[model samples]
Target: MTSTLGFAILAVLARGDRTGYDLATAMRRPIGYFWTAGHSQIHAELQKLRSADLVGFESEHGPGPQGRKVYHLTDAGMRALRDWVTEPPRERPERDELVLKTYASWLAEPDLIREMFADQLAAHEARLAEYEHHEASFDEPPAFGDPRFGNYATLRCGLSYERHRADWCRWMLAQLGRSGERPIGR
Candidate 1:
């Protein structure tokens, strides 16, 4: 995660001071969950950021407990983030496993394909439910330009994606002559 992806972790640190665990937890929110790095990856990237003077941390020592490091963005980190934001992004190849499998589905057993798509549909539904639960915490009709608006907007992205994925999986099942739609779980 040392390259541009590492910058994603840096962007999170820009928010405020966080321990490695806190950083990982922040990532589990809509933005981080969508483009993910595990806790170890976050820790590794933090070390790199520290080495480059982009981020700094203070160690809190206790009498009988292990020390904890709380990380914050250095001025260099802010400059780098500002610079990176203006850089044009490189386009990467699409590598979705489901799409790849669909391309070769004719060669596989029909029943297996049906089962796989069914499982995928169910997963998307579950994710949608989780996102909906998170959405409940927002103000009813969140105000424009508010901080919570950004959070709600990202949550909407996740919700839209899960809904589309679930619908696509059902469509695929129908195309394969299998019934796929299940009762929508609230």
Candidate 2:
């Protein structure tokens, strides 16, 4: 079975060839928003892909002991991703700590809960700003069919998610009578 990391690696390569370092750096933005992986994990997955003939790499001089290798998806890798996309995804459990905390928030101090909301509001706002900045970097003709459309589309989703979370934080603060100078409830 192709792991999520496998697909993520292929998806990254879909844009263009990249060294392992480049792939890890790319994961920090859009992919990191959804999934987390360390450099070692990424390297291991790349080795697996290479063994399976799903990806190919060209060695180039770099800082690493084995030097750097730029990876690109093979035809098999692209086909694997396409096949995976067409198949129905298996249900997996979510582990959202915020939601879990909310579920048991009744036992926590009200003031502390309000503080948490305030902190979350600030974080989401910061993320929204970052997403907006990324969106502004897109080139012209960034329509659905444009080459940079995926970047734009993902940025939109991140923006919307952060906005929604910020709104929710504001609402919770208002409900707790701790909105302070911030306006709430539209």
Candidate 3:
């Protein structure tokens, strides 16, 4: 995953040279909102990319502060990014702490489990609202209407995932409430 993100960062830099902070900010703009890596993580990954010769850096003079080291993607980085995008994604390891914790608490503290579900429901509701905002902004199907289909697809995925989460959370909360076991919180 780090390698993949490294390639993405490099690809962004391929457009033009940018400082570490600038790179991090650029990542979160529209592309980063969906495929996000933290600032520290981006910095670390940039170092790794540099060591791998996927990117090169040069110090540039600036007005408000000291000179900054700006990175540019190398030819190797472009090839790497292309290969990664074309190749099949590797299987992701499953290690959901929330699911494990919910299972662990189910027998001993069912009410707490219910409360957790309620909390998740609230969080999902907020996410659903955001998704709604995105949906409202778009007048037509993404790929059908826009040339930037890649970004549109990413936004669509986010909307779909949030909607699914909201629906599932609502169902789970209803089931928990009807189970005759009072929730842990009022």
Would you estimate the TM-scores of all the predictions? 0.85, 0.85, 0.79
lDDT of 3: 0.75
Ranked candidates (lDDT, high to low): 2, 1, 3
Candidate 1 at 63: error in angstroms?
8.4
Residue-by-residue lDDT tens digits, candidate 2, 1-186: 779888888888988999988999999987776667899999999999999999999888787576778999999999998788668877889887987997777767778888898999999999888888877786653777663676666777788888999998888888878434443232
The CA lDDT at 174 in model 2 is 88
Error of 1 at 170 (Å): 0.6
Flag regions of model 1 displaced more than 4 Å: 62-64, 140-147, 178-186
Clashing pairs in 2: none
lDDT of candidate model 2 versus the reference = 0.83
Tens digits of per-residue lDDT for model 1, 1-186 = 247657877777777788888888888885653678888878888889999999999988734579889999999898998788678986888899999999877767778889899999999999999998998876684787664665677788888999999999999988877434433242
lDDT of each: 0.81, 0.83, 0.75
For model 3, residues 1-186, the per-residue Cα lDDT tens digits are 347688678767866789998898878755654678889999899889988888889998976689888888888887887778678887889786766775565464666777787888788778668667766776776664453555567767877877787787677767777777644453
| Candidate 3 global TM-score | 0.79
